[model samples]
Target: MAINTPPIAFGTDAPSSARGKQAGKARRPVPAPRPGLVTAAAAVVGVGLGATLALTITSETSSEFTGPGGVASFAGNLTGMAGSYLALVMVLLVSRIPFVEHVLGLDGLLRWHRRVAPWPISLLVAHAVLITIGYAQTAKTGTWHEVGTLLTRYPDMITAAVGLGLMCLAGVISIRAIRSRLRRETWWTVHLVMYLALAISFAHIIVLGPSFVGHPATQVVWSVAWAASAGLVLCYRVGLPVVRSIRHGLRVVEVRPEGPGVVSIVCSGRNLNRLAVSGGQFFCWRFLTRSHWWQAHPYSLSALPQPPYLRLTVKSVGDHSASLALLRPGTRVAVEGPYGTFTRHAQRHRRALLIAGGIGVTATRALLEDLPRAAQPVVLLRGTRQEDLVLREEVANLVRRRGGKLHELTGTREQQGLDEQSLPALVPDLLDRDIFVCGPEGFVADIVATARALGVPDEVIHYEAFAL
Candidate 1:
């Protein structure tokens, strides 16, 4: 899509008073702590780190170290303990609990989950290697021989090895290059395998882990942490969505084309308002048809939920999404969300600049209908051609009726690409406005970096990438 930033009159140097007046009008009241999602997330990480530290201190002081072998054993034990703690954190992050989603937003939580994921795997790998060497040292056997014996003769090591294999496989598939090459269904299946890996590894920890053996209190704490993490996953990720889907009886009622290859699928259900969805949020939708029922895809709401109805606009970008065009009315649908923070709730200023690239307009269009009325928001829809602009006329009408601005940029990327001066020229008081951006991953990244360079604070620049 065209990515140019038009040089508007506002960008030109104006009277100091005029600039100050506009800036004053753009200023908003201070927002709540939760809007600072990154900081709130850092607090969660800090708490997790603190817990790991306490466990290490308690275990280290309680035990005695005799020699090199003892030191290796202690190191292995520490890695295992940290790995377990991080694994629990990873589960809680992807649980989809309302409290967690409300506080961190799905995008934020997923980002954190990705960051914390490698720690557990890396630590577990270290644990496996170090523990093997420690045991080999004690038994005076070759390391390879010790590993073989540990796997074949130990109580739970065989099963743990299987779990380790699964984890390693999942890790390999999760790399960006490999993951990008896979379909969403394939990627999701690999992640689901992680749950089994964790379950299978649990016995090995309790039965053979040095930190758990002969340490009743520590074992109880670890058990309780694992139990709580599992409970959250069961209650929120599994039970709640199932119950909600049953209660609402959501089904696809219509599918209408928007622009080019884009289609808007409308779902009808009972008490949709109860979902408490915000504009700019998305749902992980599963259309229960022969070909599509096995996977759920995240789609942003294209309009405000009006009782019994929710609308999602999808572009035919992949095999799963392309199948949406063939979906008939009456298809049963399961939804899991109202997830994300690219909404009015994240606005920190009186005036807003909503920028969308290509299909990303689905989110910004939804936000147009519900952003605080006083913000007098302006929307910039960027696309390569008129046909590439999904929901342009509709959003333009909304902006006009709401007394806001809508700018349509249509041309090749070379023609419309934004420059350093272009953004500030288009919106003179951009520094004082809450900026929301949505688009392809690369496009969104470029815009965000430009906004940051132009002085938008990280917190005030709300964004969600449509590509996951």
Candidate 2:
């Protein structure tokens, strides 16, 4: 349950002052993000995409365009080349490349990935249909018969067909309505099959595409581009996480309850003081237990690192989160990141307004430790009930120390709404402060929209929403 004052006892057994001292000693400077690097990298990607389109155009001849089914064949070739290149771009977007992730957070990257997704899938489908129709016309055969002939006579047609089928399957399940119905784990497993599809489809492009069939130089360049993208995925998504997990050697030391259905798992690890992570960042945590080792779920740090100790607060929302409470001491843990851009680094003004809804208080509590005393922050904690404000005491203490103000809004949404009028009335100087919000998807969205409607500029509003 929530505690409103320093003297009141909460579930936490350790004194707040002692925890603060430990955190203070463990603080290390995390490297700031370089937006310039991301901008330059994006420019390079655009140039490469343009070059690929040029290569495809230059490879075509005037006679080929005038031949039987030439128009359909040329259009098919163009779409195929563009679609394949875009598919590679889509993979790289979610590859978790450090610089890119730093500039645009994982949420931002995923949003772009979703928007770019439909293009490649649609183009590839069109390419398949056009190519089949073109071949049928040229061979003076029925479309269905041509499909069989291509599969039997062409070198890589069967594998390409399989790859296309897999891509279509992935695309179908990713539709918002369908995705919402599936469990996160199920969707993730199916999405991984796209990599396999891309791998099996590669040979067909170089071997049969008009742009690469007879050109050794173009073929070598194209292969190298694909190879580089694959290497990046392996390095960032696989190799780096493995190395870091081994170096830290973390294991669970305590599981303390904070509220109903919510607990904080404390892990003791080697060289935690050397971990360069900022407050408000999260990691993809993999508990090395038989039931959980196969999947890694993301959770934000509840507080700054306390020397050899690290902690994450989680609510029992799903099977994985519910399982965290049952974890035994000495359970090993592997982590993939200190990823996200919701930290104080994104702050734009001297003063800040921090808002937390429900379990999102975990991030706000940690971030408060990083703010300077002169910041004089104002924190708004919203929960359905007083007991739902999980980390209230610690937040109150932090606010008191920083000469900031704390206000808790505990009630149903209808009773304590945070609309445009209520928001400005609560914080009269809202326009002068940077806004940091963390919460469930709908809560975060509502706050952001309200703030924006009240004239808060986009750059000054930094947020992290908890959702699949």
Candidate 3:
């Protein structure tokens, strides 16, 4: 009779977020916790609401209720004022500030920003509708006539109307059905107009809103908050990039084809290691050439950063991406990252699974070399065809040197299914390992679902999607 070795189960039945301990190995501490940035954000909203409520109550007690019109006016003022603050929050979230990004991660912050986006516009709409009706009732006039009067007769109202119009236009363009029809650059430019809309609308609030009347403290608070939000945007989104570009003097060094429609761009910069970026992180890169200088696209660092050098692998997904292959050597570059939590810091288990589909392999391949020696990760590359595999040889070499496994799944899901059961079958003890998934949205979603079905804990599964 031949002796048989027992099949290794990845981990015990502990929650994925929990630290796993081997029989003899001492457990390591989890990543340092950021000081409750989300909690702090929620608290700010709470405080704003409390103050708004106090102001409303004070005004209500001091005057007699004048019926539906009065109620409409009150609600309009309340919602409008609240909406302004919420818009400021949205601005702060997307400001690309390091502190907030560190705490919330780019993905978490963007998701929160999206969730809060419609609320401000919704509140603004309610403000306009209710205020129009209230004013119409008070003036004993039709709503349209009253609207015309407010636009023409009221102080700062005309500018506010224009601002509101711009806001409404942006909102309409942002609608998923409408937005998908427009180019990304077109959509981005229209979205930029919202800052002007917000600025112009603020004047109407300060000059006309009764809540700010005789309340110098409240006025100062609002002014400071708006100024701070704008300052962050100007500094991080504009000033810092220009400063970094000038200081680093990044220039294109090489552009090589990885596969059909895929290109690898290598750039050399001054003191690149000073950036303190990790392998799997990404930067919003802008190449300074006539046609391409105006728009920036976020591309992940496909290789580990070395002093004076960085590499980005891009698949032709848009006009900007397709133009990358044409980039000439020495073309100046500006960057605004390495912004994300997709790096080794996200890994929780020593045994890991790195999964990628198509162009997403860029990040995973970098991680294959970057993950700690103790991680012992398995890399799964998925593609429609063998030629679709980007960096195939490089990934295999990395896996070979790292003493890991590389499993390639080519062809359609119909031709080669990798459902919940098949995935576990391919990677034994899959439930015990931390899983990193990157791919097209639908493909990534199916993998995530499979991981969950295999009882993989949420904390051990890390993934980030680029929104640009």
| Best TM-score among the predictions, by candidate number | 2
- RMSD (Å) of each candidate, 1 decimal: 8.9, 3.7, 9.5
* Whole-model lDDT per candidate: 0.78, 0.87, 0.77
Ranking by TM-score: 2, 3, 1
Runs of candidate 3 with Cα error greater than 4 angstroms are 1-35, 62-64
lDDT tens digits by residue: candidate 2, 1-468: 221222123323223233322444534578888999999988998998898888888888888778777778788888999999999999999899998998899888899889988888898889888898888888889989988998999999899999999999889899999999998889989988889889999999999999998899989999999999999999999999999899889988788888989998888787676788887899999999999999999899888776567889999998999989989888999999989998988988999999999999988888887776677989999999899888899889888988899999989999998998899899999999999999899999999999999999999999999864
CA displacement after TM-score superposition, residue 459 of candidate 2 (Å): 0.9
Tens-place lDDT digits, model 1, residues 1-468: 211222112111111222221322222222332536655765976786787766665665433456546667678878887887788788888987675676677887888888989999999889899888877877788999999999999998988989978988888899889998997678888878888999999988987765567978877877887888899899987787798889889987777777888988877776554556677888889899888887888999887665455678898988888889878777899877768878787877898999999999988888877776688878889999999998887787778767788889889778987657888888888888999999899889999999989878998998889866
TM-score of 2: 0.94
Cα TM-score per model: 0.88, 0.94, 0.89
lDDT (C-alpha) at residue 10 in model 2: 30
Error of 3 at 238 (Å): 0.9
> Which one wins by TM-score: 2 or 3?
2
